[model samples]
Target: MRGALNNLLHGVRLICAVIALLAFGMSVAAAQVRFDKQPLTIETGAGARHQLTVELAVDPQQREQGLMYRKQMPTDHGMLFDFDEARPVSMWMRNTLIPLDMLFLDDKGVVTHLHEGAVPLSEAIISSGGPVRYVLELNGGAIKTLGIKPGDRVVSRQIGSAG
Candidate 1:
């Protein structure tokens, strides 16, 4: 009976070990960026609108922490800040490590202003130029490289109803 109990204990230990390893593996698999993805488009008006995959920042906390600690981002990825109201907004690169092009847009999705190649970690104010409801941040110099400019329009579900 003593020998049988020893064998059963060993078997139970082995099973626990296996279960622990499986849990660790599952956690590793789940360690991915948690950004919510959405389809976005920018109508250049000059022709050839551009489509992108963007993460939306709807709340004040997300908007405040916007791209602060990120070291790198995919070229096609961006973050869209929606204020839900048409009002002047200002931005800065304070804790943001990666340079970005900030696109300020009105509720109608029209780009009201563009701040291209904004310096990383700079505290200087980047203004919206006018009342806006959305702000899109993309890799630095993307505005010039992608031919995006003021007068363009952004299309996304998070921008609220379009006119």
Candidate 2:
């Protein structure tokens, strides 16, 4: 009888451990951030327009988690970080799994600084040379392939422009 009780207790402990692990996994899934998608356009210097759909990272928590674990992003899809105001901003790719090209934009959505082909999983600091209100991150080499340059203007509803 004692042996049976011990076996039952062991089974109960195993069940509890499984439950705890499932709960932890659920919590982690719940904590993953979801972003709102928006339409954005980049008007190049020679009057060429490039359209893209981007996920907005507007809040502190969303910005903090900016594409850290994402393994892939679509060619025309990117993440746009709105800082709310123009200020010098810094970024890093500590846990990022894919290379990215970062475009720093001023208050008028004009690209001010560009950092292309940022190494994945790197902790090196990438900075906006000047104050910027937005940072648009795209797949590495997208800028050159799209012929996007520093003077290009980004138009989006969030940037006070018609999408």
* Candidate with maximal lDDT: 2
Give RMSD to native, each candidate. Answer: 9.9, 5.4
For each candidate, the alpha-carbon lDDT, in order, equals 0.85, 0.91
- For model 2, the local distance difference test gives 0.91
Q: Report how far off residue 134 is in candidate 1 (Å).
A: 0.5
Residue 151, model 2: Cα distance from true site in angstroms = 1.1
TM-score of decoy 2 = 0.81
Give residue 48's lDDT in candidate 2 (0 to 100): 91
User: Considering summed lDDT, which 10 consecutive residues are worst modelled in model 1?
Assistant: 26-35
For candidate 2, which ten residues in a row score worst on lDDT? 23-32
lDDT (10s digit) by residue, model 1, range 40-102: 998897886788999877777677777877789999889999888889999999868899999
lDDT of 2 by residue, 1-163 (tens): 9999999999999999999999788557646788999999999998999999999999998898888878899999999999988889999997788999999999889999999999999999999998999999999999999898999999998888412
Clashes of 2: 0
